[model samples]
Target: MVDFNSTSFHPATFQLTGFPGQEAAHHWISIPFCVVYITAIVGNCTVLCIIWAERRLHQPMYLFLCMLSVNDLGMSLSTLPTVLGIFCFDVTDVAFDACLAQMFFIHSFSFMESGILLAMSFDRFVAICNPLRYAAILTNPRIVRIGLAVVIKSTSMLLPFPFLIKWLPICKGNVLSHPYCLHSDMMRLACADTTVNNIYGLFATLVTYGLDSVFIILSYVKILRTVFNIASYEQRLMALNTCVSHICAVLLFYVPIIAVAVMHRFGKSAPRLVQILLSYACLFVPPVLNPIVYSVKTKEIRKGISRIFSRDFL
Candidate 1:
């Protein structure tokens, strides 16, 4: 065993432990992961293309959706290479710099997705709670600004993590918990001081996930109140119906993340495979399911998709 206490210890490469204790089943695992990745890419890309080509989808709601599809695409692509490499090629070694870059992209996109979801919630709130001013409030230029702001905010918040990771002395054998790199997982390998890393990670989590979730809930609360005040029951139902797809999107994105956190905190005795699967669920399920949920629940998107297929057939 290498001396972790050495002052000059720094690993050049990190070995990814993909589904530990399941080496024999890696090939079988790759098949499902491959399918999920492909589906996510195709689904999100289809959503993006339909939104772009359909004139009617130029509205604020769909514009936000276009942002979401883009975020999901980024998230999927960030994890795709290493994940496939581990399961398919049996390549588990990732260069230190490359691992840090992967961690940055994966974490950045995860936070970006939260910001996008928060923005989507705001869009729904305005459209339902204040329909008359929806267009005025969520103007095209303003929407672009919102998109840029979310990207900048999420990216900026995570920008420090890579540098922080580099500052630490990694000496715990450089074995990663998942096929992908994460700030927490990387920090754990540090044989030196990690208090700063720990504190900052918690702070980043709160500012992104915590604040965004609070605002999203607040937006929906106001939305629900506005819907309830509508004189006609049908109108109230219709208004609520508009949020069904977004609500599903939010659940898909947050539930797995929450489960992973809870599992890590409370279920330490949980099987490694189970924890890894939950982590996979956190990263993989949302991208793969978001487009399907939206396509089924949102009429305009469905119509847009149908129109494309119908045109191709004609």
Candidate 2:
């Protein structure tokens, strides 16, 4: 005999909480993020420019690197401006549509970055495992096709997320603890049952990011086995060195993601500041480190970067 419309036990709707009495802490956090954002933009832009300026660097690996740079740029641009606006100008008000748009691009670029990483892994596997067939298998036309597939596939997968959010009957607890509207955090605001959304989100994460990581690990394992079977110690060393940058990049990206997930599950009682800081850390750290890892670890890229700056100065 309970009337659904007459029920008084509605979901608790909390207002958007701004930074609470921590002006100094907020400023400190904002400064470092601004610095990191500048560094990421400059470093990734430099890498992309270097690859574009040098015709010799126009291989499949470099092409994927360029795509990664583009993805990183998109990721940074999607979240940083709003974060800076909030921290610096105290502008925490964001329209629902704008928030959804930011979330869409952030997830889209994240998925695309995962796809590009898988493509890079495939490139390395071919180059090291089957050198003779590398050129034949990863020709210009083939690379173009692969790139298009990456864009199309990532876009299709993430396109559903934002639309689903838009359709949700959100009952006014729109304040996201993190700077951006993350899938899980936004889903928490829905007044309707979110079981389907959670299931789909988990599935998307597993299929795209989780599966990509597994394949990359397998690729490296095979590469390692090949290296061990080779007679020349120098060749093994060289092969191992080639994979160093990729290994570092993967660790940097995934470790933070895992940390965020773990913290969300187990650290629910932790301070809100800790949760927000940790979540934002995961978003920004990988992009900041990616360009540095690639530049330091890849010799040709370093040389290309040098040539780019030298030309600019001339």
Per-prediction TM-score: 0.96, 0.90
Tell me the TM-score of model 2. 0.90
Best lDDT among the predictions, by candidate number: 1
Q: What global local distance difference test value does model 1 have?
A: 0.91
Candidate 1 segments exceeding 4 Å error: 1-8
For all the candidates, what are their Cα RMSDs to the real structure? 1.8, 4.4
lDDT of 1 by residue, 133-247 (tens): 9889999999999999999999999999999998998977888899999999989988888999989999999999999999999999999888888999999899999999999
lDDT of each: 0.91, 0.80
- In the range 108-166, model 2's lDDT, one tens digit per residue, is 88888888888988988998999899889999999989889988988888888887876
Cα displacement (angstroms), candidate 1, residue 203, comes to 0.6
**Residue 136 lDDT, candidate 1, scale 0-100:** 92
For candidate 2, give the lDDT. Answer: 0.80
